[model samples]
Structures are given as structure tokens and as C-alpha cells.
Target: METNLSATTAAEANPGTARDAAARHGALGTLALMIAHCAGMVDVVALPVWVGTLIGAYRLDPQQAGLLPTLFLAGAVVSSLFFSPRLNRLPSRVAATLGFCVAALVFFGLASTGRYPVMAALHAVAGIAAGCGLSFTHGTFGRSRNPHRLFAIAGLTLGFFAIAFLGITPGVIAVQGGQTLFRIFAGVMGVAAITSALAFPSLRPKRVAATPAEPRFDRAVWFGMAGVACMGLTQAMMFSFVQRIGLDRGFGFSAVTATLIALGFVNLFPAPIAGLLELRIPGRRVVLAGPLVQAALALVIAQSAAFAPYAAASSVLVAVMIFTHTFAFGMLARLDGTGRAVAATPAMLMTGAAIGPVLGGTLVKQYGYGSLGIAAALIAAMAVFCFSRLERRPN
Candidate 1:
């Protein structure tokens, strides 16, 4: 009778324990998400310009310079597969905090390093950290209440952070050198990582209710992948050549920097607007249509005769791309309903993103900046084709 009573007591306590675990998970997830967004902005705005300048200083060819971005994406790809399963099994806060700590160290190393190879290696390490952090946060968010809303908020934050960081950091460093800029960014991320580690316990992990099994090869997944690829391609073209494109069109170096800053600023507003639209329209349509608009804008950019027209077209294209990509991510999580699946989506997206700059660089080497825009437009069109095929099938 005593043993039976003990067994019953233990069984009764399990539910409460599970709920407590869920609450802890959610808190870690939110904290992780914020850190990831901040880190992402810092990287997108600063890393590319820094790496590109480093490669140019070393007199490396376009292909050689392209390796930095490729390696970064490669790190992300490898880590995404490895990170998610491990994180899923660990305590969420512990996993997130550790990942951020690793990222902070890598950024500090990059800031201190002088050898090109070491810089590249540091970028790869940072990529791994980002991959792990993003996978954990995205996976956790997917299981939360109204995950789409949470994701949209995260996206908007990411955009604003990128605009703020990239807009100011690059120009500041443009007048200085890479080392100072990287150090500043390192300090910022270090503080963020530490704070995140401390504050991770307040939010709650969501208890995942059992749901129907998702299809293994859903059309929605493919569409989401295509949309992500298109967004990646657009970004690759813009970031890789925006400065050069401006200079070639007769803009001064200051004007080039200003143009980049303007693009970042433009990115800030569209994310919220896109998030709102995602709530009203089918995500498929938004994903499919965004690239088409971008393609049109790319064509205009390619054909523009003056700096004003080029900048105008470029800004519009960027704004549309950001909105579309943000919506695609939200839709991807909604469609897959699994952290692994959502994490896997970025792998496909990053593959395209990684390849895009290399392809754009090669096109520029062969033809020119005009060819780069044309190539991007063609890729965008291809994304539309893939999206259309997915749309014909029922959701």
C-alpha cells in the first residue's frame, strides 16, 4: 500500500513538472531570439563591407574575396544540422547562452586578428554561433503562442537593428579602419551575450501540444525555400555591388556610403507592413509576388540613367525584398510546425545566399554591374516560376 501511494504521488507531480519545464523553455526562447536579431544586424551591415575591404586590401580576386561569405554560409549550413538536435535535448537557456558566448569570443578574435586566414576562420566560427543561436530561437518561437506574430516581431526587430547598426557602423569605419569597427561591434555583442545569459530565465517555454503529422515533402516547404532563395539572391546582389554600382553611376564615395545607409533605413519600415499583410493574405501569394516586384525594380535599376533614379529603384527593390523574405520565414514555420523543419529552411535559403554573391561577382568580372542586376532579375524570375508551380497545388 505504501509503494502504490508513492507511485501515485510521482505520477501526479509529472504534469506540474512538465509545465514548469515549458515555462523555462519559453523564457529562454525569447531572450535567444532578441540576441540573435541583434547579432544578425551587426553581421549583415558590417561583416560584408569589412571582408570585402580586407580582400581588396590583400589584392584578392573576386572569387577569392567571395570565399568569406561562402565560408560564413557554409558554417551556418553545417551547424544548423548539428546544433538543433543538441539544443533540443539541452536546457534552452543553457544552450542559448553558451552559443552567444561562443559568438562573442569569435567576434572578439576577429576584431583582434590580422591574418586574412584567421579573419576568415573567425567569420566561420561566428557563423556557427549564429547558426546555433538562430536554430534554437526559431525552433522555440515556433512552439509558442501565435508564433507567426512572434516571428514577425522578431523580423521587424532584425530589420531595425540592421538599419541602425549598418547605417552608422560602416560609414564610421569607412573613415577609420576595419579593426576599430570590429572592436566596437565585439564589445556590443559581448555585452548582449552576457545580459542574455543572465536574463534567460524569466520567459517560459511553451508546452507543445500534440498535433497531426506534417507531410514529409509538402509543396509549402518548397515554396518557402524558393522565396528564401530569391530574397538571398536579391540581398547578395545589393550588398556585393551596391557601392560599386553607385560609384560607376558617377556617385562619390560618400554618396555610395549614403546610399547603403539609405537602403538600411528603407528596410526598417517594410517589415512591419509586411507582417501586417501576412496576416491578411495567404503567405504563398505574398512570397510569390514579392520577387516579381523585385525583378521589375531590378530591371528599372539596371536601366536607370541617373543616380537619383538608380537609388530610388534600388531602395524600392530592397524594401520589397525584405518584406517578402520576412513573410516567407513566418510562412515556413507555419507550414512545417517543427523546429527542425524551420531550421532546415534557412539552410536552403543560405545555400542560395552563399552562392549568390559569387555568381554576382563573377558576372561583374565578366560583364559589369549592369550584368549583375540582369542576372539577379533572372534568378528572381526563376524563383517566381518555382513559386507558381507550388501555388497550383492545394495548401
Candidate 2:
């Protein structure tokens, strides 16, 4: 009797333990999504720093410098739209792991290649590989039980990483010169490639029946996509040539480094707060705030020539831009029950970013950075109008 009672009690406890283990597994999977995304997200900021090398080594003008990021983003757009959609038949682990590995190799190429054409080509290829990894990773994260919460966590993780990199990378670059950006990029990609195999949790469902049509792209979805692209354009305009602008103002290397570190630390809160606010505010309003803030940044950039004021403005801009970026995609998450839509969202962002660099660079080279301010102001107003229309339209 005693033995039977003990056996029965043990069996009852097994279910709870299983539940606990499953919860832990899911949390780990969410963390993996963050790590995977962070690996890609760092590339944008890296370009501004790397431009120093391109200009010095290749005798390239600012307009030509823009091509590198443009091509990189173009590759991301192509892979996300055409390649990743086709890769759904592959197991998530197989796709994500392979893509990460290939991308890592390309990053190594980026570190080693000194020529302009070779470096550009390598980054474009790396972008394609990154897109595939992102597709798989996004799908994996979207399947989490608390996707909104997970997104908040993702935002928080990115903010923290941004801050840490801002703090450390400037010092590294100071010591190692322009090549440090490439080396750091390679190291980050290599680390991600190794860790990614274990980062993604299985997205397979328990149902024997067919899965629901989640991640649907209705009219609302397309509108949100457009908005993301515009946001990307705005971001590229603001960040890509900023180093040149700072140099023109006579800001020293130390000043730039200190400002970036301060800015990064400040942006850490806005992402998480934006997520929390999305729970209360109309989603459109939350997103609209991003552009308005960006416009403010443009004004500050145009008016303030000093490093102190510029630093303050840019830091706030980074904070608000990231905060809004999280919510803009959150709209997609709300619509995309299947999570595939969210996977494609990053591609759409890349598409806009691809266009932004060349356009912004040309404008800056011809009309100057002040023209960028005007462009951003106009774009910000347009974004507000477009978002208003999107909000009024029903799902």
C-alpha cells in the first residue's frame, strides 16, 4: 500500500515538473531570438564607423560610400522576399544554422577584404545569409505563447547591446583603427553562428491537423510594411553620414565616443516603455510618435553645430526611434497569427534601408546635410499622414 501511494504521488508531481520545464524551454527560446536579431542589428551602426576606412582606403566619396550599405540592404531585401519564403519547407534548425554559418564566413571576408568591390560584394552576400537566418528565427520567436512580451524583451535586449557596444567599440576603434569595425563585425557573426544552432527552439506544433493561416498579410499588413520601409529610410538618413557631420564640427574622437556611449545608455529605457505603452495607446499613435521625434532630431541636427547639443538630440532620437520601431512591428504581430508576416517584416525594413543610403548620400553630397533635415522633415510629416490613414482603416 505504501509503495503504491508513493508511486501515485510521484506520478502526480511529474506533470507539474513537465509544465515547469516547458516554460523554461520557451523562455530560453525567446532569449535566442534576441541573440540572433542582435547579430544583424549591429551592422547598421557599424557602417558609419566603417565609412572612415572606405573613404581613407579606397579614395571613395560620400556618395560612393553609400553604395556599400545599399547593396547590403538590397541583398537582405531579395533574400527575405524570394529566398526565405521558399525555405519554409526546410527544418528551422537546418535553415537557421546553415544561414548563420554562411553569413559568419562572409563577415570574415569583410574583415579581410581591403578592396571596395570585394568588400561590397561580401556584405551583400552576408546580408542574404542573414535574411534566411532571420526568417527562421522570427518564425521561431513568433510561436511563443506571449509574443508581445517577448517582443518587449527583444527591444530591451537590443537597447542594452546598443549601449554596451557604443561604450566599448569606440575605444577599440581608437586603438585598432577602421579595421576594428570589420574585425568586430566578424567576431560578432562568428559567435552568433556557433550559438545559433541551439538558440532556436522547435516551432513545430503538437496538432495533428493542419496549422492555421497565421501571419496573414491583409491590407493592414501591407500598410504597416510600407511604414516600416519609410522608417528604415529615415534611420539611414540620420545615422549613416553622421560621423562626417561630426567631423565637420571639429568634434574630436573622444567627444564622439563619449556622446555615443551616453546616447546608448539613454536609449535603453525607451524600447521597453514603448512596448508597455502599446498595451494602452492606439498602436498608430505610438508609431506616429517615432517620426515626429525623428523630425525633431533633424531640426536639432540642422540648428546645433556644437557636439554637446547634437549629442543630446541624437541620443533622444535613437531612444524614440527604437521605441517606435518596436511598436510598428507589434502591429504586424497582432495581425500575423502565424508569425510568417513578422518574419518578412525585417525584409521590408531592409528594402527601405536599401533605398535610403543612396538617396540620402546623393542628397547630402549635392545639397548638403541641411538638405537631409528638410528631407526628414517632409518624410516625417508624410509618415504621420500615412499612419493616420492606416489607423482609420480597419483590420
Candidate 3:
């Protein structure tokens, strides 16, 4: 009778314990999402600095310098594509923990070397590892009760991260050179590794059926992915040379860096604003307008020799993408019940980004900075067409 009572008591307590554990996971999961986003998307802030450092500090030519970041993004594209479909079968926490840990190690290796070949190899390795962690983080977000809000909050976190990174890194690199940038990358990855290992939530994958089966994507998801990819290409192509363009046009380093700082400040509002507008505006319309606005900004930034016009355009270039992508992400999350499309965020964002730097470098090298504007216009048209093709669903 005593043993029976004890067993009954333990069973009674288990439900409450489970609920408490779930609440804890929810809170920690939000934090993990933010940190993972910052570490994974650090490229947005770091691209100009990273490429500039290679060219200015390490004496690499423009094409060669651009190649390094291209390689990094290419690896990310590959890794995200590979892991997204398999997310349901994999242990999310284990994959995220090990992926970030490996990335941290590779970034540390990067900080110790200046050799182009060696650095290139390390960048590729780091990208692949980090991409794996990022895919799991996004997939977890999709499994949440409110993926749009959670993703927007994650974007807001990235905005603050940008402010700190842009404000501090350029000055540090100015005094300490390129290695400081890699050291910072390693530290960021290390924090992500620890965070993932400790608190990344283990949400069950989205169900496509009652029985065990693979989820299939519809044509709408493919079109959405392609649209996002085009925007990614335009963003990366212009951002990779932003600092260089300013310098080449006789803008002082201080002025260019100031514009970058201003850009960070501008980034803070877009995600929250997007979140607020989610219920009011149609995502399809927002996406349709995004590409055109992005193209106009690219033109002014690339063509203007005047600091005022250049700074104004450059400051908001990234904001347009952030705002638009927030909506795109929300739309895709709803469209794909299986969660795999959203999990492939890294691949969608980085596929064209992988081609961007190298392509932009070639254009700038051959035809000068103005060529980027023309390229952006062309890509924008393609992006607009792709977004227009997406089947409208009830927001």
C-alpha cells in the first residue's frame, strides 16, 4: 500500500513538472533565437568591414578579397540546404551545440592566420558550421506559437547588435588591424555555442501527416525562396563594397564610418515596425515594393559622389531588406506547415549572397562603381516578378 501511494504521487507531480519545464524552455528559447540570429547574420554588418580589411590590411586585390566572403556564404548555402530537410530526424540541441562549437574553433583559427589560402579554408568551414546551428534556430522559431513575432524580436536583437558592432569594430580594426575582427567573430560564436548547449529548446518538428513522412514544398514556397534570394544578391553585392565606394569617392574614413554607424541606428526600427504592421498591411504588397525601394537606394549610394546623398542612401539600404524580409519570413512560415521552408532560411538568404561579392567585385573592377546600380536595377525587376508570382494566402 505504501509503494502504491508513492507511485501515484509521482505520476500526479509529473504533469506540473512538465508544464514548468515547458515555460522555462519558452523563455530560454526566445533568448537563444536572438543570440543565434546575431551570430549567424553578423555578415550583414561585417561584410564591408571584412572585405575592406582583407583589401586594406592584408593587401589583397578587390576580386581576391571579395572571393573570401563569397566562399563563406557559399558554404552556408550548402550547409543550410543539406540540413533543412533533415531537421525532423536530427537532434536539434546536439546539432546546434556542435555546429556552433565547431564554428567557434574555426573562427579562432582564422584570427591566428593571415594567409589567403588558409583563411579562405577556415571561412568556408566556419560558414558551414554556423549555418547548421542557424537552420535549427529558425526551425525552432517556426514551431513557436507566434513565429512572426518571435522572428521580429530576433530581428530587433540583431539591430542592437549592429549598433555595437559597427560602432566598435571599425575603430578596433583601425588600430589593431584585421585579426581583431576575426577574434570578435570567434568570441561571438563561442557565446552562441554556450547558449545553444545550455538553453536551445527541443520543440517537436511540424507534422505533415498522422504517420511518419517527409513534407513536400509547393510552388509558392519555391517562388518565395527565389525572391528572397534575389534580394539577398542585391544586398550583398552593394554592401560588400560600401566602405570602398565611399573611400574611392574622396569621402574620408571617418565620414564613411559615421555613415555605417548611422546605418545601425536606422536598423533598430524596421523590425518592430514590421511586427506592428503585420496585421494591417498585406505581406504580398510589402514584398512587391521592397525590391524597387532597394534598387533606388543602391543607385544613389553607388552613383553619388556627394557625401550627403551617399550617406543618406547607404544608411537605409539594409533597413529596406530587414523590413521586407520580416514579412516574407512570416508569409513563408504560414505557407509551409512542415516548417522546412522556413528552416531553409539560411539557404534562401545566402544562395545569391554567395554569388554577390565575386560578381560585384568583377563589375566594380571592370566598369567602376556605377555598374552596381545597373546590376541592382536588373535584379530588382527579377525580384519583383518572383514576389508577384507568390500565391496570396490569408494573412
For each candidate, the alpha-carbon lDDT, in order, equals 0.61, 0.67, 0.84
TM-score of each: 0.81, 0.86, 0.92
Q: What tens-digit string does per-residue lDDT give for candidate 1 at 175-199?
A: 6666665576566666556755665
Sort all candidates by TM-score, best to worst.
3, 2, 1
The TM-score of candidate 3 is 0.92
Q: What lDDT score is found at residue 376 in candidate 2?
A: 83
RMSD of each: 6.4, 7.0, 6.1
User: Which tens-of-lDDT digit does each residue in 1-395 have in candidate 2?
Assistant: 00000112222233211111222235455566677777766654555565555665556787888888788778877877864443334466667667777887887777766787898898799888877777766655454445555667776787788777777776776676666676777677666666667656654322223322223367766777777777777777777766667776788767776776776787678767866776677777777777888888877875678887787876676677677777776677666544556667558678877877777779878988788888888878767765655644221
Candidate 1's TM-score reads 0.81
Top-lDDT structure, candidate number: 3
Q: What is the Å distance of residue 309 in model 2 from its true position?
A: 2.4
Candidate 3, position 146, lDDT: 62
